[model samples]
Target: MSSIFKWEAKPFFDMVTRRQTLQAISTTALPALAGCTTDILDSGKSQTRYTLNIEPIEVSPVEHALFDPDDDALFGNPAQTALAAILPDGRHTTYGYEPLPDDAYVEYEGSYYQTTNLVTGRKQMERTLIRAEPLPDKADVPNDAILVDELNRPAARVVKILHSNAVTGGEGNSAELLREDAYVLRRPVERESRLATGELDGRIVTMTDGGNWAYRLHVTHKRITETAHTTLAIEVANSHSQFRDVVFGSRIDVELTPENLSADVRNLLEDAVRRETYEETVPLPETFEALLTALGLKAVDTAVTGKLLWYDGELYRCALYVNDSS
Candidate 1:
């Protein structure tokens, strides 16, 4: 397949926990774990049964020249063969020579194909369009906000931490919260190559389309290290298997760079960026509770009050996390 729903790829997650089980979606019935218990889903209470199904997206050698700034992208494939018009008798030919609907199929040589997507090739009609976005810098936390890889390594540059908002008991007034991260790479024909965080059981992600590339979008969160008086650590990385216990003066010196991200992780991030872009807005806070469950994150110290989401180079206020560490 070419793409997935908005919440398919979870960037900031550790799926190798002892509390999860693998299940086949097609063979077995999916449990209704949407709102059962946050303990197992969030704070690692019991265990979770979830997996990520990721697909690669095609990216033009040149950036999207016609895509709008507000538009988010998941994936794209270039239309080959010249345009054509479908005749009442099933004949197909080039455009401008004959009037035709945007979605009409065209013929080339001896074969017939669909018309090119709008604003491309002929720059006329709308094609398959969706909404997707990858990691963008948060305007509030320009200095503190950092982009990391799947290994929780810094994928982008190190911004100065002007004010700490990714800390406990604080509003994200000026924080570049981790919202979405894009991974670009070859199509994940194998299980390990796919953009997955939790239990993926035995599903296969095959790239059937001629499009050779793939992209995935992920909303990953970095580990939060808080001290009673000061914030010690706040960076995205898959360093620890789980959230490190709230430590007092000690801070783990993570020196990982973007390149340090595993090949699969990086590919997942890029693929997310190329998939799609949409304009519909959802209640992030209300949906974030389930989102954390999907990602397999637990709450520590204090219960989750609210979250900060990074999108379109801005941080949006979001929902609370887990209630307890089960």
Candidate 2:
């Protein structure tokens, strides 16, 4: 993500004066801490803040699945066997059957078939089974029967798998099939409270002359206190109109320090920020990794709040606010 500093000299000085005035009044009016002198009054209080105004010639949206089942045990089978079965109507059909699951079912042509008396060996793999029963007719099929495609995989656009027959060791119980797919393509409706206690890295860029001039800015924040609350803002400069129709977004990965947290806490925070920010959108900027490398700092955890605007042939400014407190 890229960000541009938007401060003007006069306004910046004015803001500082205002903050100083407020600080003076508060310090004089507020009660003093017990056994503490004015010199140490700022102890235990800290803050960090930065602002950026960005103009982009283009915007883009990033799409991601809430949950992907490609690596899930119940959703995938490796080295499985595909065999042909004769239906009650004497029609030949082919399906996939795995030796791992006890149910011994075949999936083919958009349906499941229950298999029995299967004889198997290196050369006997082609022998006919004594009985292969197709699932109850679609009319009789339970309302909850999982909809599988012609490939026998869960047919719905599955976002999550809440409960599954494979997971619970059940047989022929359609209700036990994974139903989390009911929430397919659903967006999160709530924001979760999370902690920012690790390193963060991001890119910065600047553009001027109405999409004709562009350059990068290197930023680094070092010596951040352990367990500090960190927030990130990304700014983008669109110097060309070539990418006008595309939407942009960010993917952030934070590696936590195992020694600094307990297992439970680590798990809770590992992807906490990412889950919330994945849906947020952004633009292009300088490489944050380069900035960190120059500063001899490592990348860590962060949370993102995104703002996007459409370019209207006028100067567009997007602002992202970062507030760090410890």
Candidate 3:
């Protein structure tokens, strides 16, 4: 639920006059309105039908991370398992050794060694290395080398070596200790934007998936005898509804005024204004369809133009305009 404040409606007679001039030109110069007669003296009077125009809206982008760092398959150590060899009769021959693959290089004894002629059980479950060749140093290892842990499993690629230290073993042999970059093995962030447009009950509606969410334009017309009425409803919804409770707040302030309108048309516009204004707090609806019902705004036979201001908190967000003349 949200609070709505009602304010006095102000008129913009200049815009109304401009709309009237445009309507006159559209009716006379355009073939669509041909055969329509307008008496100069009675031009101030309202007529029966009007036109509706819609504009395109944009949505902001959202970002998402691609990986979780705590997964065991990417971060766990595999050096605890014992190496074994598979016999021809399915007997197991266990060996006290690291399970590295043949030709695989590793930084050992302060140098690099390439294993060769590796012997292993089914599915490489047990590995027995025949021999290894000495390499110059870690500097010789390729940046895109196939990295593997002690158990011969795939290891995350190292992006950058932050720090390195030499560790002395019980036999006085030295090994390299490396500090890897934090972003190594992590995928890049992805940004997404979603947009949709459709017609609902003759009204053109466009939706944006962001804080400034929905934009809707509705136009309707009715005719009676020699008089005609046209109504335009411009609706905007922010992301503060029930589905987007994190948006904090949203507000829409609308103003409408009638210019050079006949007595009957003026009365109709006044009634529509009264219906559109809210004097009590109302529950903020989730969907635009529910929002229209909550706001009590409906299309009626009237001649007027409207100005709309949308906001979130004290910041001015968006604006929409409607010009109706008959």
Candidate 4:
């Protein structure tokens, strides 16, 4: 975004345009690979290393169940499914860092409704949403359940659906995707997109920022035709606040698997990956477990390690996967 200083000149990265992005990975120091979509071909040299870690985020049992996503149970209907289709992987799956701060509301097309019968004096419960939120964040909202943000801008769909019968009152069940990994208002979707994700079912072991800036990467896996892409929704609260456009683009590959990983780490990865097929929001296998972990991630991270290398002279971003059919 800034012209006064170039990315290759500086020690960090910034959001870059397609023209500004280079196809070559410069190697004055560390042996590196090239391109955002290219496979990692550098065979490990003096590349910058970042260790992947996942710590437990504190939450009440009730809160955890309410906010966390379900792995096995189908979490959406036709409307919910339609809306989720437009989301960029990590946004729908990424957990909220904060508990929505109470008083806050998201755009929701879903709500609890009950109908009463005049003759029998009976009540029936149902869940429904017609069109759904327009933008990935929120665009032209046609649903009454859709919500708006502080600026009255359209926001993510968060619905508290109710279920009950004519006899019982109702119970609340929410189908929400708390996509707060990035600053939705300040850094809108237009400027950012999912890059790559390196995940394992249990623990994630990959490269990090090497301790310059604190960042959170919400990795999302996407399959395009025959190519598998791991998109990273990188959210950073950087200490360096001068630059507004910061983009860390790179790839992530599962370097090691459970069979080749440390015994303790392997057990955790296997358990987390397998358990997800039937459940959601599991306990952390190990604090700061090196490598990768996430949904559909177990298929990628079975006893694995992840390595990331940034191009040119920049650091921060890491390596991800690209399924090579040939």
Q: Is candidate 2 or candidate 3 better by lDDT?
A: 2
Model 4 has a clash total of 33
Q: Stretches of candidate 2 above 4 Å error?
A: 1-44, 48-50, 53-55, 59-317, 322-324
Q: What is the C-alpha lDDT of each candidate?
A: 0.25, 0.26, 0.24, 0.25
lDDT at 282, model 4: 24
Clashing pairs in 3: 47-228, 47-229, 48-228, 48-229, 103-115
Model 1, which residues run further than 4 Å from truth?
Answer: 1-52, 55-85, 88-101, 111-326
Judging by TM-score against the true structure, name the best candidate: 2
lDDT of 1 by residue, 1-326 (tens): 11212332234135433233223322222332433344346555433222222222133211211121221111111111112122212333322122223433332333323332222123242111111222223222222222222221121111111112223223454333321211211111111222233221121111112211111223232333221111011122222222121110122111223364555544443343343211111222333333333323223222332232222222222222222212
Report the C-alpha lDDT of model 4 over 56-169, residue by residue, as the tens digit.
Answer: 224322222222233321232322332243222222211211111211111223221111111212222221111111122222222332121211111122111110111122
The candidate with the higher TM-score, 2 or 4, is 2
lDDT, candidate 2, equals 0.26
The residue ranges of model 3 lying beyond 4 angstroms of the native Cα positions read: 1-45, 48-56, 61-244, 251-326
TM-score of each prediction: 0.13, 0.16, 0.13, 0.16
RMSD of each: 31.7, 29.2, 32.6, 26.8
